[model samples]
Target: MTAPMISFEFFPPKTAEGLAKLRETRKQLALLNPKFFSVTFGAGGSTRDRTLETVLEIQSEGHEAAPHISGVSSSGEEIQGLLETYRNKGINRLVVLRGDLPSGEVSAGDFHYANELVSFIRQTTGDWFHIEVAAYPEFHPEARSPSADLMHFKNKIDAGANTAITQYFYNPDAYFRFMDQCQSAGINVPIVPGVMPIYNITQLARFSDVCGADIPRWLRLRLQDYGDDLASLRAFGLDVVTELCQKLLAGGAPGLHFYTLNQAGIISTIASHLNLQGD
Candidate 1:
C-alpha cells in the first residue's frame, strides 16, 4: 500500500514558555517527514508577525511550512507584503482562510469571503505560491445552505486554489459525503481530511461547538466514562483517531492533516500507526 501522506497544523506561541513548547513540537514532528505543515493566523491579524516568524523557523529547520492567511483581516497591500516576505524567505505555500469576525464587532470589509481572497491572491501572485483553501465537511456555519456552501467552495477552486483542507471532523462518512459532493460539483482538487485527536473532552467539545463539527455521542460517552484519567483518555483518543484514519483511507481519502495542538506525542503516535515514520 502507498504510505498515507500527512501534514500538521500549529499555532503561534503567545509566551516565552509557549514558544519553547512550539519549537519542541516542531522538532519532534519534523522527524515524521510530513508533506507540509501550517501555522495558523490569529483573528484580526493579531499574530501576523509571529505567524511569519514561525513559518520561517519551520522552513529553516528544513521542512515545508505553509502559513495561514486571513483575507478578512488583511488589505490588498498587506497581503502583497506578506506574500513578498514569504517569497523572500523561500516559503511558497499558504492556507488561505476567510477568518471569523473579531469578537464584539462586525466585519469592516478587507475581505468578505475566501473566494474573493483566492481571486486576489491569484491576480497578485500569479502561481508564485501553492495556495490551499479550507473546506467544511458539515457545511460552513455562515453559509446559507449546504449547496450554497459547496458552490462557494467550488468558486474558490476556480479562483485558483490548488487544494482543500477540511475542517477537523470525527465522522468519516461526513468526509466521504463531502468528497462525493465535490466530485459532483466538478471540484477535482485534493480534499485532505483534517484529523483532531481529542486530548481533552471538554476542550474538544468547546472547539467543536465553535467550528460546527459534531462530536458523536459514542465518543462523548467514552470520554465521560474515562472521566479525569489522563492516561486512559489519551489511549482512547489515539484509538479513536487511528480508527478514523483507517476508515478515511479505506474510503479513498488522498491524505490526512492533523491538528497537532502544538504537541508531538499524539501526532507522532498517529503517524507511526499509519507507518509514516521518517527515515
Candidate 2:
C-alpha cells in the first residue's frame, strides 16, 4: 500500500511570542511535507482576522494554507468577502463549518447550519475553493441520532463540499464503520482521520468531554491511574496513538489530519514513529 498523506490543524496565536513559536513549529513540521496546514477559526468568527493573518503567514512561507470559515456569526455576504480576499491571495482551499457560539451568543446569526454555509460558498465562489467539511465518526454530541447525524453529513456533500475531515477519534472501528455507512449512503469523498496526539491527560479529557470524542473506558482508567506522572503518561499515550495510526493507515485511511494545537513535539515524535519524518 502507498504511504498515507498527512496534514495539520492549528489555531491562530494571540501573541508575538506565540507566532514566533508557531513559525518554529511550522519549520520543523514542514520537513514532513504535509499536504497543507489549516488554521482554525474561532467560535462565532471571533478570530476571523487572526485566522486570515495566520494563513497569510503560512502562505507567505510557501506552504499550502487552508483557513477554516465558520458560519455561526457570519452572513453570506460576509463570507463572500472573505472568500474573495482568499482568492485574491491565491488560496484555493478552505475548511467550512457551522461553528459554535459562546454563552449568550446568537446560535446562528446569519447562517444556522454548515450545509447552508457550504452551499453559500459554492454559490458565491463557483469552484474557486476546494472545500473541506467536518464529520463525526462516533456521532456529534448534539445530533438527534446516528442516521440523522449522517444525513447532516450528507447535506454538506450535497451542498458542494469536496472532502471531509472527521472529528478526532481513537477507535479505528468507528472510523471504518463511518466510512462503510458513507459508502452505503453513496457519499464518496476522502474522509481523512483527524488524529489528536495525547499530551496532557487533564486537557485531553476535558476536550474529549466537550467534543463528545470517546476515550474508551480502558484508556480513560489507565490515564487516570497516571496521576501527575506526565513522562509516563506521554510515553504510554504516544504508543497508543501511534498504534492507532498504524491500524488506520493499514485499513486504507486516505490520510491523517493531525490536530496539533499549535505545538510540534508530540506530533513530530508521532510522525517519526509512523516513519513519516522526512524524505
lDDT of each: 0.88, 0.92
Residue 272, model 1: Cα distance from true site in angstroms: 1.5
lDDT string, candidate 1, 74-110, tens digits:
6888888988888888888999998876787676457
Q: Highest TM-score, which number? A: 2
**What would you estimate as the lDDT of candidate 2?**
0.92
Candidate 2, residue 165: the lDDT equals 97
- Evaluated at residue 144, the lDDT of candidate 1 is 96
Which digits, one per residue and each the tens of the lDDT, describe model 2 over residues 1-279? 565778999999999999999999999899998899999998888899999999999999998999999899787788889999999999999999889997687558788899999998888889989999999999999999999999999999999999999999889999999999999999999999999999877999899999999998899889889999999998999999999999998899888999998999988998998887321
Off by over 4 Å in 1: 277-279
**Deviation in angstroms for 256 in model 2?**
0.1
lDDT for 66 in candidate 1 is: 97
